[model samples]
Target: MLSTVSPRVADPNVRTALVETAARLLAEQEGLTIRRLAHEVGTSTMAVYTHFGSMEDLRRAVRLEGFARLAAHLDAVERSRDPVADLSALGWAYCFNALANPNLYRVMFLEAPIDAEEAESGGATFAPVVAAVQRCIDAGRFTSCDAWSLAVQTWTMVHGMVGVVLAGVFGPDEMLGHLSTMTVSLYVGNGDSRAAAVRSLARARRRMEPHAPIKRSDGAAEFERPRIQNAAP
Candidate 1:
């Protein structure tokens, strides 16, 4: 009979360290080698093998970790009285997740050879956006269009802007303001009244009011989101 056993990692924390270190290094465009990774995590190269099976597996794990973090942020957006406001909050949460984890964000989307499994798994992260859009449609705030399609459209617009900001095309300080502008246009076009869309946008922005773009020592600006309470699953 064949034995079924998972590999034992002497230190579970080492696995987390390896994944995070590799993601940060990959984002910084550092030359990644097994020895370098091991050195950074203060473990032998064998630990990587024990934890992830191989470097390719570790890369996939890193991408999955990025999605996990993103899902957490989306799940943090509570359902509000207005479905439109709730939808806007979901988009903001997605953007804030990327801003907070630029390194992981790059690894999640920019890396090549995205396998079928990884791609499918990553698609799950968009579920909340789709559900939120459906709520808007059900509430008669949006036209009777396909919810998934609109959600994808919204995601594409937001992700494109985020990618540009991450590439230093512009400062992150203007991101929320720009998102508000674009989403209002999108919502209005999809049958929502402009006044109601603006109101929803304002409500969403207010939730993140505790945070603003702050400059790092390197003088780069980044947005921070405060912890929201009573978030629905």
Candidate 2:
């Protein structure tokens, strides 16, 4: 008797589910096996092979998805009159994506060795940051520095800060504030634009945050909103 193949085997929805589940499992338990993933996804091990040629391929897909989502998040950030604010928005969006998908984030940034495909994915993810830096340079907020160098430096800084947060050394509340401030200061200070940097940071923070308080139907502020709860180290 021929076994019926699930039409979803190669569907994008199933592929996404498998990739997302794989990332979460890999993040929760480093060194996740294909067999385990199949068991968790409630499909035959063949499903893994069908969707992704192998576990390494699955991991690659997971990493690629992470970068894809990051690119979209950064893309949605409105490019406004404030170049510094625009750049800062990209910076924090990086962190927001990390917190939302720590397991996938780790896999994308740290878990595995990078192959040619992974390199391409990584480059695509950082292109927005480079563009944002260029905007700052054009606005005279970053002096004569090349956009690539500044982009790489700022990314390295944010990457290191996120690593520290993921390593349990720094809580998000404590470290994110310090890291973000330092990044803005470093960029603006390098251009002799300290005062402008201060204003940029203030404006960026205001723009990212909700000015009006979140109120319940009775009008009391929803003080219970736990901002930054995941501490997956």
Candidate 3:
């Protein structure tokens, strides 16, 4: 009787190693081939399919991982007592993160699709910016504007600056930091004194009111009470 050889199942460690190798390749080349990647990883195209479903899927995973790292950078910025300062820090973090991870950064903001469904389902990869924008609004640093719109605006400004830097429109060290600062300044609108006073008053009122129960709105609990809180006398 002839002996039969059994096929090996893909190990998680091996799969992760392959993915990491692919991510590195994508980062370096920006346009990498699966055949080349498979050869580098000593795996078959079938293995890549089995592990990541498709090349698109793998790219999405890589981009998502990059966004997670970027979010962590933003999170590390100190929570400033001044909302404007905090907002500035958030914007700075966005630009810095992109500069730090040029490959992953390009994938996250520039290479991704602009479809509505993709935007809605992009998961944690996209949530950090929205959450950060909401935080600024909640802190009364930004006027009462839709968080989604503000998030897009902030993203546009930061991403535009990063793009200019990456495209060699300017030297990497020359105008990058200056452009980032200017972008943040434009977004914050020269520190409106009247707006800041209004925000302070609103915050004071919110803190004095008792916590109200959330009500069901279209199957979701809505916290109707204003978010800003006043200090105790």
Off by over 4 Å in 1: 1-10, 211-233
What's the candidate order when arranged by decreasing lDDT?
1, 2, 3
Pairs that collide in candidate 3 are 207-230
- Residue lDDT tens for model 3, 44-104: 8888777777787787766666767676766666554555445545555665566556666
Highest TM-score, which number? 1
Query: Candidate 2 on 138-184: residue-level lDDT in tens?
Result: 87788868999989888988888888977888876656567756865
Better of 1 and 2 by lDDT: 1
- Segments of candidate 3 deviating more than 4 angstroms: 1-31, 42-47, 112-147, 187-233
Superposed Cα RMSD, model 3: 13.5
Q: Which run of 10 residues does model 3 get worst, by summed lDDT?
A: 224-233
Q: What is the TM-score of each predicted model, taking all chains together?
A: 0.86, 0.82, 0.59
Better of 2 and 3 by lDDT: 2
What's the lDDT for residue 195 in model 1? 92
Clashing pairs in 2: none
For candidate 3, report its TM-score. 0.59
Residue 210 shift from truth in candidate 1, angstroms: 3.2
* Candidate 2: residue 209 lDDT (0-100): 47
State in Å the error of residue 59, model 2.
1.6
